[model samples]
Target: MACLSRHRHHHHHHHHHRAWLTSPDPDMLHHRPLSAHHRPLPHDDALPPLLRTPHPPRLRHGRHRPHPRPQFDGPDPIWDAVRQEAKREVVQFNSLCASVASIAFLVFHFNCVQAEKEPILSSFLYASILAHDCLEQALVFVLANRLQNPTLLATQLLDIFSNVVLHHKPIQRSIRLDVQAFKDRDPACLSYCSALLYMKGFHALQVYRIAHALWHQGRKVLALALQSRVSEVFGVDIHPAAKIGEGILLDHGTGVVIGETAIVGNRVSLLHGVTLGGTGKEIGDRHPKVGEGALIGASATILGNITIGEGAMIAAGSLVLKDVPPHSIAAGIPAKVICGLQEHDPSLTMKHDATKDFFTHVATNFRDEMPNG
Candidate 1:
């Protein structure tokens, strides 16, 4: 009975800590309540020099602090490194979970189409599909070198993460802001971020990071092997040799083609069924070169050694055979410049929306020009 009474007295000694750091001036001094929970925040004189000096968490009564700065002496930097690495691992594990889930959902949906019960598969699929994009986005940040930028990285990362709770904003706004934040942090990120944004659903660079590791360590073949796996898995069909840029949007990207020696510029948009192809008998950089901010609309085929100039627009269903001028709107069987539209301007505002007759006339004229192949 005496020991139980003594334990209660001991508990009461630290019970005062709960309301300890409730100070109004957070900007000047971060006053945390004195408790085991507050341990993560520093206490007194033992703070890092960056956090040194007594910016004390004063009481509500405006009196000097009663406790010496809580001697913050125990957070092991080494352990902190371990914790950070663990955090990255958890993020990666979450990514794998997302990938697994997406694949499982696809499988379950496929099975549902057949009216079959894929029991074990269905369970895992439902769980995995839910987290698929979460992981993909997290993976996107992990590989972007965004974390290395320190300033912009934190801001952009927070924005990317905050998107989950930030209801009612267009996904593109979040994407664009994150990309801009990343670019402001580092210019080199322009290319990588562009490519990653367009190819957000694809983990191309994550695979490339692994491949790069192998290539530098004299594992050329092994790296290329992983590169092939990335292509097979992602299905966007980027060549290991092709150089791509940042802020790209590969919309509904299946059956999208990118050829060897192709150089893609920043902020390019390639929609579903778009082909950057070559003449069958040709080889060596003979494929189309996509320019920056250029939108290769759905089913737009740019064949042979054609350069679609910067900010150009290839209308949906257009097939290009010649070099397109910058900012020109090209369309139809043998594509022609019907008008000019800025790439940044969305399609609803395009003059072409008001000019379907012009495209029909051009299509009619061009069809007659084609050799009956």
Candidate 2:
């Protein structure tokens, strides 16, 4: 009985050991149920593609995928259009100048061939027209005749002026437009060559452009000097800091005073003695802002920081103290709005006559509105 009991006890111990090895403890298998501070990682689907660390699947076909392209912004369309127009104008003006020069050369050659006498006129023509290649070279030669002095030699001045004009694309465009403006607006300007060779208004504008460029570059002393020269030569006192735009027509430009803070817009016309000036001793921004397509008649004095509206007409000798409305005809001493203007630009028409009936009505209304005192 003792031997049988020993055998059963051994058998039971062996069975218990087998069961423990076959099945692990439930608490140990679960890994002690993660602590409150130790949370499980987020699923791959919850993360952004860039942040996710999952491996990409292998392609069945052996081809690789192409990457997507990046996008960028381009230049403004209006500015691009402006640039294109300027380029076209420059090309046309240059071509016209070249043709004129060519014709002049042919005439000089014919005179030399036909006449037996000394070719004095031919020599002059060769020096003036046949010698130069472009409008800019001709301008440099012409300006040199007047601008050369003891302190600044003609050659040195020419180099400086050429560098300024050639380096600046805007200056070239402005020059072409200014020439076109003269041709379009001034009756005296019979030809492009005549405007280039003779017009004081055109000359003054080009000098001012150079001075303005210098002023922007922080060479104020040289700019002021050029301004003084322009004033002396052309009698047009345009401050170097004044902002004048393209297609400007300064008719009989003598005594035209544009102040330092003045702003003249594109396609504007100003007759002789027109002053875009300050009213008093005030400092900052104390000048007139002349709008596009506005016409200021001869001797019109527009003062202060007021706006002369687009397509507005200020009658001759009028003194404007306040803002003029757009497309309105302003007249009288203090310059009241006499009547509304037509859709066309008055500057282009070169017309100063406001309707006589409209002027009469305005005068009548003014008298009626006045007190009995």
CA RMSD of each candidate after superposition: 18.8, 33.6
Q: For candidate 2, lDDT tens digit of each residue in 1-373?
A: 0100000011111111101012222211122333453233233344322212212111223322111111113212212122222222222333223332312211012232333343343333233333332345446555655566676666556656766775665675566667667776898876555566578888888888988999999999999998888798789999999999887888878999999999998878899999999989999999999898899998999999999999899988889999999999888788889879885677777776674665677689999999999
Model 2, C-alpha of 193: deviation from truth (Å): 1.2
Locate the minimum summed-lDDT window of 10 residues in model 1: 1-10
Model 1 lDDT per residue over 1-373, tens place: 0100000011112112211112222221222243432123223233222222112222233553222322122221211222222222222333223332212211012223232332343322222222112223233333333222433343333233233222212222223322332333323333322334334333443344334444555777755654564556555565555555555555555667776667767656676677887878777778888787677777888888779898788888888999998887888788888877654523212233523767767679989999997
Residue 265's C-alpha lDDT in candidate 1?
74
Candidate 1 lands at a TM-score of 0.44
Candidate 1 segments exceeding 4 Å error: 1-201, 204-220, 342-373
Winning candidate number (lDDT): 2
Against the true structure, candidate 2 reaches a TM-score of 0.64
TM-score of each: 0.44, 0.64
